[model samples]
Target: MIALLSALLQGCALPSLEGRSESHALKRAETADTALGRALMPQAQARPGLSGILPLADARDAFAARVLLVRAAERTLDVQYYIWREDITGNLLLDALSEAAERGVRVRLLLDDNGVSMDAKLLALDRHPAIEVRLFNPFSVRRPKALGYLTHFSRANRRMHNKALIADGQAAIMGGRNVGDEYFGATDGVLFADLDVLATGAVLPELSADFDRYWASASAYPIDRIVAPEGTAPAPVPHAEDDPRAARYLQALRESRFVADLLAGGHLPQWARVDMVSDDPRKGLGLAEKEDLLTHQLQQVLARPPVASLDLVSPYFVPTAAGVDVFSRLAARGVRVRILTNALEATDVSAVHSGYARYRKDLLRAGVELHEMRRGAQPQGGGAGVFGSSGSSLHAKTFAIDGQRVFVGSMNFDPRSAHLNTELGFIIDSPVLAQAVTQAFDRDIPASAYEVKLDEGGGLVWTERRDGQTLRHKREPGSTLVRSVWIGLLSVLPIEWLL
Candidate 1:
C-alpha cells in the first residue's frame, strides 16, 4: 500500500519549493480578522449579522461573494479542500489566489493527497512565490505508474475531508462545497447535495487557529520539500506555459444552459441573527484531533429530554447501534424526531448507506421521521431538462430542535466526521433562524423527497408526496448510470474511511 501511495503522489508531483520574497500581507490579514472579530465571539453578541436559514439553489451570489473575499484579501489566505479540479471554477479560484499572492498575500493551500489523480494543474500554482501548497497524508511512492495496485493500511483509511477558506484571519466559508462544478451546481447535467456557511466574526479566529494547527501538523509537507531540484527529476508535465487553455474549462461551463438558469436564481437568504460556537477550547472544538464537534454536540443534545419536534437533514446518514439507542431514548421521551437522508439509490456514497441500513430498523422502531430526496425537482432555474433528469442527491447537513437552535457546517453524519476527520460548522441559538430553516425544510421535504413509511408487510416503501406516487427502487429514468456504477463499485471497496 505504501508503494501505491508513493507512486500516486510522485506521479502527481507538487510544486518545487523556491524561496520567495515575503510581503506585509500577513499584518493586513491580521487586522481584517480583528475587524470582524467581536461578532464571532459568543461574549460579544447573541448573533452576528443576519442569521437565517437560507436555500442556496444557485451559484452566482455565493460564488460572487467568494470571489470578492478572495480578491479583497490583503494578507494571509488559507484554503483547504478535498477536491480541486482544473475546471473553470477551480481556475477562477486559483486566479484569485494568484492575484492575492501577487499583492504580497501569504497564501497556503491544503488538499487531500488522494485526489492528486484528478488534478491536472496543481504543479503550475507552485511557480508563484507567495503561494505554498501541501498535500495531507501524502502517499510515499517515489516513482509513478502502477501505484494503484499497491494499497497500504495506514492513511489508506484516513482522509482530510474538510472544506474551509480563511482570509485575513477573520472571514471564512465552511461547508460541503468543494472545488468542483457539481458542488456549486455549475456542472453540466448535474447538481450536488451540498451546503456551505459564510461567516465574518469571532468564529474566524477559531477557524484560523485550527488552520494554523493543521498547517503545522506532522501530516503536512511544504511544496518545496516534495519537488526535486529543477534539472534533477523528470518533468511531471511536459509544458506549463504551453498549456494555452489551462483555464478554458470554465468556458464549457458557461455553455451549459442550466448554468445560466442557476445564475438567475436569487442569492442565499441572509440571517438577521447568527450565533457562532467553537467546541470548548479544551478539546480544540472537536476538530481533526478529537471527536467531531458536530457529532459530539449531537450526542449531547440527544442525551437531553425530548422536545416536541426535531428535524434533521443529512446527505450521508450512517447511524451506529449506540447512536440508534440514543435516538430511541429521545423518542421514549416523547420527542417527535424526524430525519431526511439520501435514499439508497439517491446516495453518492453507497457504503455510508450500507452502514446506515444496519440501523434503519432500529431508528424506525424508535419512531424517527425519515425521508430521502428524490431524483428530480424544479431545477434552480424556471424549467428543467437534463438538469432535472439527472438523479441528483442530497448534500445538505443540518439539524433543528424545537425551532430554537440550528447547526450548519461541513460536517457529515458519518463516522469519519464524527470521530476521524476535522470538521466545522455554526450553532445558532435563535428561534427565528430555526423557524426559517425548519420552514425551508418543510417546503423542501414535500416537493423533492419521499417519506419512508412502514407497510403492512413490515418493510419500508417510499411515497412521493407531490402526486402520491409510490415506488420501491430509488433509480429514476434518465439517472446517471455512470454515477450508479461508480457508487456501486466504490461501496464494495473496503477503504471507505479513506474516501
Candidate 2:
C-alpha cells in the first residue's frame, strides 16, 4: 500500500499531443480592422493605453461587457480561463461565441482541465468550423474525479489560472474574474467583488504572444482528441437558438448604465500607458520558481527601490512566513501597507481563512493595516447593480503602488499563486488607473469591511459602521461557537502552504 501510494503521488508527464494543425490568431501578422481594432490600433501603435473598468463590481455590467465585446469583434476572439460553468452566464457566453464563429469569425478557447464538467458543451463548441478548444494539462481519466487526482496529483494540481479575453489582437480584457454565475453576479446567494481592465495597443502583442506560447506547449491538448475518445459525445456545433433567459438578460444588459452610456456614443476612447507582465510558459509546470514567476517580476519592479505605499486586495490571503517577512520589511521602510481580504463568514474557503487568521497579529505588529470584508448583504430588490445583487466577497487580486501603478490579475498573494499555478496580468504605469483602483479601495474598505486593530492586550478587535451605527465585535463577527471551534481546529493543521 505504501509503495502504491508513493507511485500515485509521483509527478507524471503531461499527455502526449496528437497531430493537430497549428491555428494562430485570426489576424496573426497583420492588424485587426474590426470596430475594436479600428478604434484602438492606431493609438496602440503609438503606445499602450488601459481603461480601468469598475462597473464589473456590479455583476450585470460584468457579463454585459463581455457580451458587447463579443458582439463587436469582427475578426477574432481568444479566451483563456480556469473555470467556465454551464449556467446562465457560461451558457450565454458559449452561445455568443458559437454565433460569432458562425459569422466567419475565428475563435480560440483554452481552459484548465481540473474540475471541468462541461464536456458536452465544450466538446460541441470544439467541433465548430471556426472554433477550436484546448485543455491545459488535462487528466487521462475523464471522470471519477478522485481516481484521476490520486493517479496524477502532482501534475493535476498545477493549473493555468490565467484569465483573459482578447479580440482581434488589438484589445483585450484581463483580470481575475472567471466565467461563472457567481463571478458575474448571476448567482443568487453571493456576488464576488472582482476587477478587470480593458486594454488596447502595446500590451496586446505581448498578451497574444503569451497566449500562443501556452497554446502550443505540450501541456495543452486538443479538447476533441482527449474528451471525445472517452465515450463522450462530440457533435458538430449547430446554430444557437435564442434562450429566453438570455434574451431577457440581453435586454437588461443593453439597459445597464455602463452599456447604455457606451451606446450613447459620445464618450471618447479611454486608454493608458501600460506594460504587460507575466510568467514564462515553463512556469505552468512548476519547474521554474521566482526567476520566472510573475511574483518575481513584481518584486523586481518594486525593488527599484519600492513605492511609497501599497494597497492589496485578495480574496484568499495566507501570506506565508516569507510573505510576512516581505511585508514587514516594506512596513519598516515606511511603506504604508493596507490589505483587504474576506472575513471568516464571508470567505468561500474556510481553510484559507484559517491560514490567514494566524497572520493577523503579525501584520498588525508590522504596522500593516488589516481589513476584512463582511458577510454579504441581502440582495436589495434582487438588485443587479455594481456592488452585486446579493452579499459581497473580494475576488479581485489587485495591488496599487503609491497611487501610480495598478495590477489586476489571477495571481493571489498566497503560496499557491507564488509556487504552484501559472498566472497572467499587466502592470500599468498610469496615475489615472492607479487612482481609480485606490479610490475603489478607499471607498469599499470603510463601507463593507471590518478594520482590525490589536487591542492593548494583544487580542484582535474588529470595528465597522453599518446603518448609521458603529458595530464592534470582540470575537470574529458572525462566528458561532461551533464555527469558532472549527476555525481553531483548522488553524493547528499543517496545511498552511496549500492555502
Candidate 3:
C-alpha cells in the first residue's frame, strides 16, 4: 500500500481547468430555450418573486422532470451531483443529455470525484463537444485507483454532497436523490424514499450561479485531465445507441410516460417564492475556514430555534451528542420531534445504522418520537413506493418545522453533512408544502415505520404494522441476533465522525 501510494504521489499531478472559466450573464428570453423560456418568463414574472414550487414525491416525477428539463433546454444545462453512477439510470440520463447536446444545447455536468469511480462511460460522456464534465476535488491516482484515496483520505473525506439539475437558467431540481436506479426507485432490491423539488420560476439563476462557482473554482478538474494517458474529447459524432448497452438506456427513456407528462408542462405548479440555499463548494476542500454551513444558513432562514413540532426524515441518522441535546431540549419545551430513519434490515450502509442506533435510546428517553423504517413498509393503501418492490428504506433528507416550513435537500442529519460534505437544499416557507410533508411524516410513523419505545424494563421495543396487522418485536426486526451483533460491534468502532 505504501509503495502504491508513493507511486501515485509520483504520478501526474491534479490537472487544471484554468482557461475554462467563462462568465456570462443569465439572459432569459435571448437564450436558445426561446420556445419554453420565453413562455414561462411572463407568467413567472407575475408570481411574487420566485414561486412555482412543486414537491416531487414520486420517483417517476423526479426522474421525468430532469429528463424533460434536459429536453426542453435549448440554451444551456447545468447538472451537478455528488454521485453519478454509470448504471442503467445514469446511462439513460447521459443519452438524453447527448441528444440535447446534438441540438447545440451546451450541457455542463459537475460531479463529485469521490462519488464516481473513473470509468469508460464518464470518459465517453466528457468527450462530447457540447457536454463538459468537471469533477470536484478530484483524486490524483489514475492507475491504482484505491491508492489515491488512502494517500489523500483527509482531503477526499470531504465531499460535495449537492445534487441539482438546472436547465436554460430558468428551472431546476434539487434534493437528496443522486443519479442511480436506487434513487429513481428502479433498483430491484432496496429503494430509497427520496425527495426532490421541481421548480421553474426565479430560483434557477441562483442555482446556475452556484454551479458556475464550482465549475470555475480551483477544485473543479476537467475529466480529460484527471484520467492519465490524456485522451482528446471525442468529436461530436453519430449516436452510439447502436451498442446494446446504449440501446437499453435509450429504450427506457423512449418508453417512459414521464417523458410525455413533463413535456406537456401541466403537472407542476407555476407560482410562489422560494429561498435558494447552497454551501460554497470550498466547504468540501476545507477552504471555507470562516464560512458558515448551508445548514446554519438554513437555520437562520427557518428563524425558529424552538418550535411546536419538528418532523425529520433522514436515511442515515447518527445524532451525535449535540444533536441529542437539541432534540432533548426541544422535547423538554413540549415540542414534538418525530424522526424516521432506516432500520437494520433496510439500511444500505451498516456503519451508518450502527452509529445511529447508539442514540435511539437516548432520543426515546428524551420524549423524542423515533420511528425506524421497516424493510417492507408500504402506504396504507398498500401502494408501493418508487421501487414498488420488497425492500424500502428512507433516503429523503427533509424536515418540517412547526406547520409552516419544510426543508428538503441532500443534507442528512449526520456529522458528514454538517461538518464534511458541502450540501444544498430549499427552506421554503410554504405552509402548503410544509403540511404535505408533515402529513407524509405522520403517515409513515404508523403504516411504514417501527415506533421505537421503551418497555418497563428500559429496553427497546419496536412496534410495526404490516399487512394490516400490528406486530411487536423486542429486538431488531428481521435478523435480530445477527443484526444486534453487527451493530454492536460496529458501534464500538471510532468512526461516528465519518457517518
Candidate 4:
C-alpha cells in the first residue's frame, strides 16, 4: 500500500534524468573547452563606476538595464537567457538588440530551448545579420507529433536554466530575472518579486566569460535553426548593412520601464557598492564543491552564537536531515530560527510539498519557526500575485540572516536545486538590501502565512491569517484518510527523478 501511494503521488512527472548518447557527448565536448573555458579567462578591464549591488524590483528596471547595456556596446554583446519570449517585454529587448546589431555591435544571444515558444517576430529577429542567436539543448516539440516525440527524449535529462547578459565585454547582469514579464514584475497575473544585481567592474569579465562558454557550447543551435515547416515563410533578416537605423535601439531602451526604474530609484549612482572579480566560473568546480561553499557560508554566519534571530524565506524548503541538524544546532544556541515555505494547498508543485511535509514535525520539534504561505498572498510593490489567488502560491526564493547577510536567486532550497540544477546567487553584504528583502519577507508573513504551532495537547496546528481574519487549522489536514488512501495508491511510481 505504501509503495502504491508513493507511485500515485509521482503522477505526470517530467523526465529529470536521461542517459547521454555519443552524439550528445561529442556536442558537449566540442563546447566544453572552447566556450566554457573562455568565460573563465580574464579580459581587459573597463573604467570603474559606482560598482555595487543594485536592487531590481520591477520589470521595467530589468528591461531598462538591458537596453542601456546594448546601447553602450562598442565591441560585443553576449546574452544568455533561460527564456526570451516574443511577448511585449521580449520584443522590446529584441528590437534593442536588432538596432545594436545594425550598428555593427556583435550580439550573440543564447537561450535555453525548454521555454521559448515559436513566434514569427522572434524568428524574424533571429534572422537578423548582426544578431547570432543560439538555443541550448535544441528540441522540436512545437513541430508535428513525430518530431515532438523524437525531440522529447533528447531533452529528458539536462536543462539550461542560467540567465545572464553582458554588453561591450564590460558590464553584466546576473541574478534570478529571466527575459520574461513574470520574472520582472511585468506579467499580468503573476509577477515574480525577484532579485538581480547589476554588477559592474571585475564581475563583468566573469559574467561575459560565462555567457561565452554557453554560446560556443555543443547544445547551442543557430537562430536560423529556430524555424518552421515548409508552409511557413523563412523569417526575414531585417536590418542588414543597408539599414542604418539600428542605432535607435539604445534610445528605445532608454525610454523603457527598465531604465525608468534605475533613473527613478537612483540604483545606478546610489546604493553601496562591492567590486568582485572571479578568476574562474564554477564550471571547473564540481557540484559537491558548490554545496560545500554554501555549507561554509552558512557555518560562517552561524559560527557566533546569537541570542536574537534567524529567518529563512525560501519558496521551496526541502532540507535533508543534515540541513535540519544545522538549524537545530542554531536553535540550541538560543537563536530564534524561523523558516517559510509554501503550504501544500498553496504549492504549485505538490510533490515538492510532499517531500517537505515529511520534515514538518522534525523542524517544529527543533524549535524552528516554520511558516507556510497561504493562498492569495497579495502582491506587494507592483509584483505579480501567484496563480490560483484566492489561492495564490509563493514563488520567491530568498534567505535572510542576522538582519545582515541575504542570499537571493533562482535557487530553491530543494534537493534538485541544491544538487541537480546549476544555481547562482550573491552574498549581499549590504544591510540595506538585506533589510529591504527581509522587510518584504516580514510584510507577507502576516496575511499570507501560517505559523506552525504546537498545542498543549501535543497536537500540530497551523494558525493562518486571511482577509483580515486569523484562523487556526489542523496542520496535518486533520484526518489522514486521504493520506492513507494516497500512501496505498501513490507509492509504486517510478517518478522520483522528475520530482
> Once model 3 is optimally superposed onto the true structure by TM-score, how far is the C-alpha of residue 50 displaced, in angstroms?
2.7
Global lDDT of each candidate: 0.59, 0.75, 0.77, 0.57
Worst 10 residues of 1 by lDDT: 380-389
- lDDT-best of 3 and 4: 3
Per-residue lDDT of model 3, residues 1-499, tens digit only? 9897677666735665666656553666565347667756776877747667777766655777787788888888888999987666676788889889989988888899878874556777777788778888788765565665676777778889899998887778888889887777556666777888877777767777788887877778887778643356543323445557556645665676665765576565736567777777788778774446787687668665646888888889999999999999999999999888888888889989989988888999999999888875676665533222233777888888887877878999999988888888887777787776677666645777788999999999999887778899986786577777888999999999999
lDDT of candidate 4 over 219-314, digit per residue (tens): 566645544534466665343223333234334545555465554544443234342321112321232354344334445544664456666766
Ranking by lDDT: 3, 2, 1, 4
Write down the RMSD of all candidates, one decimal each.
6.9, 3.4, 3.0, 9.5
lDDT of 3: 0.77
**Of candidates 4 and 1, the better by lDDT:** 1
Q: What is the lDDT of residue 18 in candidate 2?
A: 66
- TM per candidate comes to 0.74, 0.90, 0.91, 0.70
Candidate 1 C-alpha lDDT tens digits along 1-499: 9898677556654343254322222332346354333323342244444433333334533454466568766667889887776655666777778778889887888876665543334555665677778776565443452342254433434556677887776567776667766665555555665556666544555667666656665566665465344465333533322344433444544454543542343433344445442332222213233343545555565455447777777788876666688788888889888887876667766667666665666788788877777754542223322112233777767777888876777677676766556566677665765675576556656566767766677676676755555555333322377755755565566644433
Better of 1 and 3 by lDDT: 3
Query: In candidate 1, how many Å is residue 125 off?
Result: 1.7
